[model samples]
Target chain A: MELVEKYLYAIGKKLPRKQKRDIVEELRSLIIDNLEDRVKEGEPTDEDISQILIEMGSPAEVAKKYCTGTQWLIGPQLYDMYLMMCKIVLGALLLGYSVSIVVSLFSSLSGSGFGQIMWYIAKNLLSIIPGILAAIGAVTLIFAIIERTSKKPLDIDFAEGGKWNPSKLEPIPKKEEVVKPIESILGIVFTVFVLVLFYFYRDKIGFYYMSSLGDNWVMVKIFSQSALRTYLPLWTISWVLSLGMYIWLLCIGKYNMLARVFEMIVSALNIGILFFMANGPHLFEFDKLGADFIDLQPAVDFLTNNQSTIFYILAVLSIFGLLANLGKLIVGKVKGRI
Target chain B: MGNNQHTTDGLIQELRRGTLVLSVLSQLKRPQYGYSLVQCLAQKGLNIEQSTLYPLLRRLEKQELLKSDWELTGTRPRRYYQLNENGKEMLQELSDEWNRLAEVVKKLTQEEEIK
Candidate 1:
């Protein structure tokens, strides 16, 4: 009798809450009926109860049979997308972290000792674990909510019965029309890495070297504080917008009119920022390197002399890139590929 | 040899899974408590475990194919299940489909044996 109660309790605890009591009671009655038929003469012994429970299988197994609805946080319909998103996020984080670590090491090499460099590398590597974990959690949480809230077959349109149209199913996109996830993932990683570099290590963007074997290492920051401060906001905005657009394209998984328009706007912003910076200020701080650095002074002087010309070249390159992107968009539109 | 026996058991289980629902539904035309239904099916040489049958009964009731009530006035309380209108219609349709499927399978297998 005690064993039966224990078995019933084990099964009951695992059953879905709404139907738990009824299921438990029904199972109890079934067990009792089986007992009455078998142990006709007297109170059922432990042996009889054990046999009945054993035949019914384990408590967890029985409970699972009665669990009617979905028991997954992310159901099958969304599971593939969830897995892909996880892979993308993890890949992006790893690439971005490695790039940042290498850039940081290069920027700091002139000033820091070998031991310090090793410590920095260790710290950067350790930091990646938490970032990876948090990103995974965020992706999982988003998919879980979608699984619970959305209709089954998660990609189903919201349009009611007759509102849908066969014409709305666009033709199979050409290779170029499809937004390759890897491209967007790379774009996302690059934008995030650049943004982090400029925001946190703005002064470290420079030249670093030792003039001679016994000489102390020296570094000269390329950009003046005022110049960097002036451009930081624009850089931040452009990169943030690019990051958002890349993520959106990744989710949509195709190139279309809306994406084309957004890409053009971001390109225009880049052109404007580069052109303005090209004409704006004495962009590099040449005095910081000075004439005293024996081996590197000539190189520093040459860079100082040609800083404006360099900026102008960069601006022209950017303009060309923007034109190329615009031309592709036009071609895609004419071909009905967008 | 053990692996072969295991494979055979799995295939047999897969074959039985669909028909188990039809078997339970066929027996539910008359009201029967969980134990009695189990016993009746067992007597007919259709052995279903108590755990399987009880949950299946609840599921059928949930689907509105069967209706049930607790008979507390009996010596001991027991929930009795019988087919509702929907269940009768379902059973008829399923029976027709099963007969056709059985005929097709029988013909194909017989032809294979002849060859």
Candidate 2:
């Protein structure tokens, strides 16, 4: 009787809350019925009861038949995607954090030693961990809900897609038109690198002209903080367009007329934005640059006085570069070279 | 186990699983409690695990093929199951299908034997 009660309790624990009481009662009665029948001829000992329960099977195995729902937080269906998301997010976080920490530390290397720099980076990485964990938790929760609701596995391939039609497959990319995955991936990395660069290390950018401050020659940037702010919006749109084009190339894996035209449009927009920023208020901010050092006086005077001329030179160069690429792409399309 | 023995066991297990419902329905014309049905089927040489039978019985009842009620039989309460109208119809259709399948299997095996 003691053994039977314990066995019932074990199985009862595994039962779902909604149907627990009734299921437990039914299971208990079955056990008692089987037990009473076993010793009907004579009163049995505890050994007999235990032996009978043993033949019936373990509590977990018996309960498993009644409880078919999986208990895992993320089931097998969504595990691959969960793993992949974590890899991508954590990889980017680590890469960007390390780069920024190094740049920020290197800029202000006056009082801090190597150990201090290392400690600062280590502390910052630890501080950002909660944000990373929050991101991971959100991804896991979304996937877990999907795993429960989604009936089919999430690995349906392009050719084996649920609604795939043979006619939907495009023609094989021509040799010249083939968008190499390595090239497209490099483009995406470059765009992402620039995003990280401007977001964290914007001050580190621009011409770091070596100028004498007393006996020491320190690097001074020609573009002031205000000048960088003027370029921010232009840089943002260019970054977005570049990233978008990279994704489009990755998905299509070829140079179609649509992609070529999109690239051309983005290049035109960037060129226009560059010229507009060059002609904006306080382009070089020579009045401000004059205070940096006496040694940079000549360079600053020439830059400030000839600011429009220098900007026009830059604007014309970028225009020529973009126009040449556009011409090459058009010629390639016409000749089926790309 | 030998590959031939493994194949036979798998085939027999599948065959038993497919026909388990039909066998249970045929015996459920009269109301029977869980253990009683287990013994009744055992006597007819269709032994099933007690654990498997209980859930299968509940599922069939939930599906409306079987109707169950709790009755105080002797000292303890027992859940007795009886076939519903749906169960009776299902049993007849399954019985016909079983006959057809058995005949096909017999003819196929006989041809294999000759080969």
Candidate 3:
């Protein structure tokens, strides 16, 4: 009887909470009926109970028989998009972090030996793995929520009173008009990653040098407090707008003239910010570079002096991007493709 | 050979699954508890598992095809299920459909055998 109780308890644990008590009670009645038939003279043993339970099926298998519809966190409709999002995000994280660590290693090479720098890179890389895992978990949770809550997941609404009609489906776009999902996904990932980096790790973006004590590496941030304070808000706004635009493009799965105009405006604003920084103030500062970086002082001085040149180069590249986009827009308009 | 047997068993299960609702509906013409229903079906050479039949009975009840009550007069409480008016109508329609399907299947199989 205790074995029978234990078996029922196991099955009850897996049963849906709403129907748990009633189902368990019905099962108990059935089990008792089986026992009465089998154990005519004496009480049914654990072996008898075990045999019945085994015949009934495993607890999970039994419970699954009661569950209706999808029992998964993410359903079939959103699974492909969720998987694509994960791959894009994880790939970006790996590439971004790897590049950052390698850059840090090279910058601090004069402070530490090659082996020591490699060791630091490995440790830093290992530490970021949890962050990557959290990112994947966040993505899975969001898709799961959408799956649970949305009647038509991923905007794949059934046409005309929920009856899916194949003939009414939109024709596939031409190559030129097709908004590449990968492009939008990559753009979203890059913008988000960059925004996070600038927001959280702005202070860490600098020359890494071994301190005079030789006990630890120190970072001398490239941007002055004044510079970051001035640009941070502007950078956040533009990048956030880019993020929104990419998300919109991803959802709509196509590009339009308005999107092109929005992109151009964002690009123009970015270039404007770059040119302003280049001309307005001495953005790079080496005040934190101590005597430890004396040997690297000349190189740092050169970089600080030519920081404006770097900004000019960035602005020029952005201008070229803007022109290229403008050219495409004009061509599209002329061809009546927009 | 083992794979072929497994495939055949799967097909047989699928075939049986299509008839399961009809079988359960047919039995509900008389009030029967879960275990009594299982026994009744087994006696009729249709051995449905308890796990499958119990949930199905609940589902049918929810669908308003069957009505159930907890009969607590015995030593242990038993949930007795019987066909409601809706259930009786559904059973009649399903029985007619099943007979029609059976005739088609029989004709097809007989023709195959002759060929």
Give the best candidate by DockQ.
3
Candidate 3 CAPRI classification by DockQ: medium
| lDDT (tens digit, per residue) of candidate 2 on A273-311 | 767766775566533332455677887788777877777
* Sliding window of 10 residues with minimal summed lDDT for model 2 chain A: A208-217
Give the per-residue lDDT digits (tens) of candidate 1, residues B1-115. Answer: 3568888999999999889989999999999999999999999999998888888999999999999998884577998999999999999999999999999999999999999
lDDT of residue B85 for candidate 1: 99
Across all candidates, what is each one's fraction of true contacts kept? 0.68, 0.64, 0.76
Model 3 residue A298 CA deviation in Å: 10
- lDDT for each residue of candidate 2 in B7-35, tens digit (9 for 90 to 100): 89999999889989999999999999988
Give the best candidate by TM-score: 3
Note the clash tally of each candidate: 0, 0, 0
Q: Each prediction's Cα lDDT score?
A: 0.83, 0.76, 0.84
Candidate 1 similarity to native, TM-score: 0.79
Candidate 3 or 1, higher lDDT: 3
- Name the better of 2 and 3 by TM-score: 3
DockQ of each: 0.72, 0.58, 0.78
**Best model per lDDT:** 3
| CA RMSD of each candidate after superposition | 4.4, 6.6, 4.6
- lDDT (Cα, tens digit) per residue for candidate 1, span A208-301: 6555563455566777889889888987888999998998888778887788889889878887887777777767775465445666777777
